[model samples]
Target: MAAKRGGAPANKIISDNRKARFNFAIEDTLEVGIELKGTEVKALRSGKANIGESYAAEHKGEIWIYNVYIPEYLQGNRNNHEPRRPRKLLLHKREIGKLALAVQKDGKTIVPLKLYFNDKGFAKLEIALAKGKKLHDKRETEKQRDWNREKSRLMKNLG
Candidate 1:
C-alpha cells in the first residue's frame, strides 16, 4: 500500500458514473489507481469530481481514463491540470492481462464506473468490464424495472 495520508480513508465515493450501469452490462469490476496532479487531488478531496462522462481506453497497451473532469482547485493558479485530460490508470500486470482477455474474447470494453478515494487517501477508479447494451436491451431493462416497481406497489396495497 502507498503511504497513508489525511484523516479519512479513501474508498469513499466522490462521483458516480450512473450512465455506465444503464448503458452497458457490467461483467466484472476492478479497482485501479489514478494518476492525478496535486490540484486535481485537492479537488477530489473536496469531492469536486465527475466520472459520469468518463470512459477508459487502452493506448499502446496502457489504460487511460478520458473525459474525467476534475475541477480546477480554487487556490491553484496556472499549474492546474486540464480538467478533462486523459489520466492513466495503474493496474497490476495479471489484472491487465485478464481485462485484455475479456475485451478480446467478449468484445467488451472497460468503462469507468466511478471515482473515489481509497483508505489511504489515494484517488481510486472502479472500472468495469462491460458489453454495450442495444436499444432493445435498454428498453427491456427499463420495462423490467417498471414492472418490478408496479409489482411492489400492488403487493404493498394487498398486504
Candidate 2:
C-alpha cells in the first residue's frame, strides 16, 4: 500500500478590490493576518467575501479593518457572525508603527487590496499604504488605461 502524498496548500484569493489601484497611488503593501470568527471563516471559504469598500486604520494602537463584508455562513444558522463587523488586523509592532507614522505624518491611507487564504491555509489581508489620486490624476489614469487597451488590441491584430 502506498502512503498518501499531501502537498502544500495553495494561496486562494477570496476577494479583491480592483478599484483601489485606479483610485489611489499605492506606495507600499503588506500582508497581515485577520482575526475572524468561525462563521466568518466558513463564509470566506465559500468565496462570498467582499473587500471592495474596506479600509484599515490604526485604532487604539492596533490596526483594524472596517467595512469588509463577509456574509453569514448559511449553515451557521443561529451562530452566524456579523456581515460587516470591524476586524482586527495582526502585524508586527514595527510594521504597525510604520503604518501609523505614514498615515499621521504623510496623510496616507491604508486600504485593503485583497483578502485570501495563504499557502498555510491562514487568512491574510493585503493592505496598501496609498495616497488618494486627484481628479486630474484619475482622468490621466483612465486615459493611460484606454491607450494601453488600444495598443494591446493593435498588437494582437498585427500578430
Candidate 3:
C-alpha cells in the first residue's frame, strides 16, 4: 500500500481515481456500495483494481458500474472472474431516480471518484454527479493548483 500522506483513509482504500476531480466539475458526491464476486473481492484486497475508466450507468431502473477492471485473482485456477465486467452499484431508490433524471435532463455524468472498503469491510464506491470541464476550465484549475502549491511553500518558509 502507498503512503497515506494526504489522500484517503489508508486502510480502507482499494483504488482511487485521482484524475476524476481534474476532469469533472463535481457538484455532488455519494457513498454507494458495490456488489462484487468472491474472486473480485480477493483482487480488490490485493489492490489490483482499476476504476479510472469506469463510470456508472442506469440500466433497467438500476445503476451499474461499467468498464471497471478488477483483475482476476491469480489463485483462482478456473473460477476467476472477468477483468472488465459490469458491476452493480447499490443505492437508494430515490438516489437512483435523481441520478437518472440528472443524466437525462441536466446533462450531468455519474463518475466514480474512488473505490474502497468501508469500516465494516464492505466495498464502497465514491461517486459524484458532475459536469465535464472545458479546456479553458481545465487550464484555470491547473493554474490554481500551481498557485496553491507556491503559496503553501512560501507559508512553510515564513512560519
Cα lDDT tens digits for candidate 3, 83-138: 99899999999999999999999999999988888766788899999999999999
lDDT (CA) per prediction: 0.87, 0.93, 0.91
The candidate that achieves the highest lDDT relative to the unseen native structure: 2
- Backbone clashes (count) for model 2: 0
Q: After superposition, which runs of candidate 3 have C-alpha atoms over 4 Å from their true positions?
A: 1-11, 157-159
lDDT of 2 by residue, 1-159 (tens): 996367645778999999999999999999999999998998999998999988899999999999999999999888789899999999999999999999999999999999999878899999999999999999998999999999999999999
Model with the higher lDDT, candidate 1 or 2: 2
Model 2: CA > 4 A from native: 1-9, 152-159
Candidate 1 lDDT at 113 equals 86
Report lDDT (Cα) of residue 102, candidate 3. Answer: 99
Q: Cα RMSDs of all predictions?
A: 3.8, 3.2, 5.2
Q: What's the true lDDT of residue 21 in model 1? A: 89
Model 3: lowest-lDDT 10 consecutive positions: 2-11
Q: Which stretches of candidate 1 lie over 4 Å from their true place?
A: 1-10
Model 1 scores a TM of 0.88
